[model samples]
Target: MSFLPPWVGLLLALLLFGALAAWVLRRGLARQAANLAQVVTGEDVQAQAHRRIQQQHLADLDRALTEGRLNANQHAAARDELMRQVLLDQAQAGTALQRGGDGVTGPVRWGWIVLLLGALSGLSYLQLGAQQTWWPVPLSQRVQISATSPEQLAEQTRVWQQATQNRPDDAEAWLTLARLQAAQNAHAQAEQALARVLALSPEPDLWIERAQMKALSAGGVYTGEPWQWIENVLREQPRHLNALVLAGSAAWSEKRHAAAQSYWQRALGLVPADSEAAQGLQQALAQAQAASPAAELAQGVAAPPSAAAPGTALAGDARPVIQGEVRLSPELQKHIVTGATLFVYALAEEGSRRPVAIWRSTPTSWPVRFALSDSMGMGAPPVLSSLAQVRLVARISQTGSAQKQAGDLQVELPGVKTGVQGVVLDITGR
Candidate 1:
């Protein structure tokens, strides 16, 4: 059953239901027909028996009169009595036949039976069947309402607003209303609904979401109350990924490149290396570094005391030696094209777009071992050995292009010290 597709299973179930219903209906109709036949046959049999008995009594009375055993008056009285009894019996049999005819012994109405069975089957299916299984569009995907008319959207918004009002304590209702309002760009109303949701739920993620709504309402500026909410969340859960990302964006908006880098770096370490969120954060970090290289270098030189953490870069002499093993996820193994280019590189900083040392090759097997040193530097001065720490990246490019493209598998290992060994970079995502 699990191997069958949803539609196939649904179809099989419907067919089986139809067959069973037909069988029951046919059997019932046949039984009713047989009962009707039996009622008619019984009436005929009773009439024949009454006729035979009356005929025998009349014949006996005539013979007795002829032989002088009974007189005419006596014979006439006896005949009348027998006839009266016959009429009573006939009357009782007629009543019984009438009752049978009025009940199940009557004619079977094919139209009514078909209609009843069909209706019952349909109702049962509606109650028991998986309704979405046969739908043309899958329900798993989010329904896109962007193409809806303005009037329709307004009607939907009104409905959701009424729902929230009716169920004031329902956090889900409030959250739904907030999302609807946000979709309509009604940021102010969305924020209000979100506030109600936060009051009811009070989860950290909800707080971050409300903070985002506030930022959107404030023209994409996370100042005032939005920034305060983010700060509060960070203070409580310093490693909260969403709060860190939001804080980084806020700092970037304020032209605080170093702070943004720090926040994003911490957030980056929390997510899978090949995830879209990590990629976006890495891109943002690169832009921040490019915008203020001097700040990045200064921050690198005088590292904060907190930078000594496991994921953070440690202050040490630059040693240009990084060795790592790159592997593809089992599911992605079949996607590896023949003669594909494999790029193993090291970034001078955690978020630098340009690679300081790069080693490119065509790999033919799994778990490719790689080593990067100062000699493989793309340029002098800012080589791998000149940096205290570097971020390692391994990519399998189908098109053999140096730039990342669609369908390219890649992975990253950030905050790797210069003399790192046995680093594993798994190309698990595209």
Candidate 2:
């Protein structure tokens, strides 16, 4: 059934109740009137019977007087007595009519009864009928389900849609819909649903959930409101596990290695060391440490020495270097943001994934010049001067993170030798 507005339903109820009360009052008054009419008719019938008897007695007295059976005084006295008795009967009938009329037709008696009934009904409604039981609640808002199949999930989604539309105040329903949308990878819709849920009850965990969805919707970049939400959660609950993890991830994405490490370390301490969450956290920390040159310096770890390659000298004075100019292709120039972080590094062609030498800068112009040397080595052996063959790579990170994320422009030149000068690296594509 279509739902009516609360005021409309209330008005309809009042109208129906009034109609019922008026019907009852009218029936009661008609019944009382009928009874009064019966009483008046019975009094009239008794008066007519008395008059007939008196007339018959007077006729018998007149016959007796005319036949000399009784004297004039006797007849006159009997006649007067009969007349007095008739007058008394008439008076009694008039009193009976007056009493019956007053009892049945009085407005005060019926009016008081109607008022009492109305008052009782109103009190009952206030005491018992004013709860949500009488209110029209959407069925979808009250039901809970676990949907395992695609069809069931669709059905569940429709049900929740109806629930949210019909009962906007139901926070739980909105939250359930948000989770369902997130599970389906509909991040935009999920974010919208989470917004409603947050407006209703802004909890830390819910804030984290919303931030995650918003970041996912924006291609895993948390540079806007998503970042703000994560910060809010951390501010409210510093030790919140999910918030800490997400904050660490955001910092890591933005190349804030120290902050990421700090957040993850605090979060790691909160979980069981042998748990899967701890294992994941350990892996992330290891990756962050590997990527961050400052992290290596902070640890004060040195790489083991290795034999130098042909034509490459280990002497600090004759250090092998590769100097290059990084340029964006014409087609990809539009993707580059001003002040974006540019990473120019040399990696060994064969073995380790770590960079032999790395250069980081925020470039404001195209055709940015970059030079990599052993002096910029990430505190490790197999530095730029020792590599026989190296791969030159240049990437621009719009988010300023060293990690390669989606939409970051990059280019790689394999089989490049150290001491190569004026090498051209083009960030031709994403």
Candidate 3:
């Protein structure tokens, strides 16, 4: 059973329940059949006895009149009276036998049993099962609202809002409505729905969710009143993943790189290394590190000798792979602004100045390690994999331009062949 798919388990459970219900119905029907048999048997015996007694009474009346014990008028009157009495006695006996047969009780008892069974089944299912959700919705109508397009979600939000209005006390329904509203960027309305949920059942996750809604309403800002709610949840459950992610994003947006790093690093530890969430966090961490101030050790270091082996595969690429560290000179760092964009890339050793692979960073720290491989390759043709040799370049482009400009500080490592190691490019004040 544990190995079976969830839907299969559900199907088997439904079949079992149906069989039980059928057995119960069959048993009730059999009891009714037994009651019918009792009624038939008793009625048959009573009718036979009544018929025999009636015949005997007629005979006795005929014998008396024949023996000449009375005149015609008296005999006729007595015979009429005897016949009337006999018929009265038979009707009284039949009424008694019918009552004694317990015929009415059968249907009445069955009716009560049926009602009880129905009520019990309904109540049990409502209490223990998924309630309305327990029943399978038709496949065509069961589109998950979360996965729907923005337009579809907008329509769904209206429908869900109307439903929640009709069922004001339904906490789960309100929560669902809140999510749909938020998805459609109706943050204010979503917050109101979340308030209703909290009123019904105050939960930590709800608080965090409401805070997130508030943040979205403020155009991705995570500070002010909303942060209070988020902070409260974090205080209670420090390892809460959603709260951590929200906090990190908010900090990053605010340029509070250190705080963002703390929150995101914690979250990174909570997820699997290969998961998408982990990958996203890794990217975030890399950005955070780049935004940090360059370390002293990376200042003014000479480039490592080119270690490109003649037949060696690019760092790890089947073709050319260029791996190195890019750093701004300490003297240059004094002139550059904290958040200036840095572009580090590799180009063909000869030909047009188009890049094979590129990475952009805003460095707060120096000597940021970089790897250029096929995965990071851009544009059509002359890919990193096709290059036998390449030139690596790093540019601190205050204007965020790829082409060289007057104010840009640039450095290049030329004639570096594929599969090089310990290659370093340093930007200088020269």
Candidate 4:
């Protein structure tokens, strides 16, 4: 091999590269053929939108919203958007059809060529990228097996279960098992472990963990159930930072935006501004503000010496996803965030203090415009009409000293014409 000239080596290398490229392209085409069936069955909203006019069709909706045909949330949702293309097509039927009939010219050919180039670029990346191994997992099984695979997790879980089984009376083991189960997404098992651990004693971390689980996807993000758990812990230990963050995220996930804001804001105060948890909390706060400028805060109180406080109340953010009337105007939209952390819930009964019904905010919190527009008729919803007189306070709790005024909201977002419309609202910002 060393005897070959540099030009010969280059030639051989280019040949192999060409062959490898052809081989990779063939493999990609095969994958595309296999995925054709799935692609056919999937929704193509983007393609559909591309075919129609977005701006014109949304005009009526925009006008209606401005003229008070819909509320803020409703206006934000922009109803009849599904028919925008239809409306645009009908409006310009003759002209568009005539132009399309006169097509097949130089520009048309150039357009297809441009499209082809884009497709080729994507194909080239897909062909060449197969060899790039950014992940530690083997390429073949990467899709099927996650870095944190369930089987790998179950193995550790078994050891945790065994520890609890062998030492049934050990609170610490029970606590450890509860944490493991939650990590494993074994929610039922985690709850059981937490119950046993709670029977032993009030472990702040365990309660925080329990609250964290509730804030997680399983508890239906923002269900406020985590808040209840954290509330209990906060009742005994006001400065529990985990409880604070969990309480903030849980409250936010549960659609209690103001409560979430207050808890997280207070948690930031107690937490060092530069800490990981606090930074996360700040992001959550910023996201909340973006979705809606919401508020709360309370003084830090050290728990009693005998108390089982972890001394650090740290909880991850469950950034509230807000959905309701557009309390803030379009001018406010600038100040309002593209980031969302909103969740909206209806009372089990009209004016019912208990929030049996809930909407959750998570990493994927969507704007509560369209989805909840029709959910108003859903199970035990609040009958909110325009000009409903009500005053609400957002309470941020620490060790159970709740009702510390962290935030407030009026039933009506004064002066704005839109009324509240339900959606899985995201109150996002930070």
Question: What TM-score fits each model?
Answer: 0.36, 0.37, 0.37, 0.34
lDDT per residue, candidate 3, 5-96, as tens digits? 34554555657666666666687667667766776687778778877877887777778778987778887897788778777877876676
Question: Residue 279 lDDT in model 2?
Answer: 75
lDDT (Cα) of model 1: 0.69
TM-score of 2: 0.37
Best by lDDT: 2
Reference-based lDDT, residue 427, model 3 = 86
lDDT of 1 at 118: 83
Query: How big is the positional error of residue 47 in model 3, measured in Å on the Cα after superposition?
Result: 77
Cα RMSD, each candidate: 19.9, 19.5, 16.1, 35.7
Task: Report backbone clashes per prediction.
Answer: 0, 0, 10, 45
Q: 324, model 1: CA deviation in Å?
A: 47
**By the lDDT metric, which is better: model 2 or model 4?**
2
- Cα error, residue 399 of model 1, in Å, equals 51
Error of 4 at 365 (Å): 24
Which regions of candidate 4 deviate over 4 angstroms?
Answer: 1-149, 214-218, 221-225, 293-430
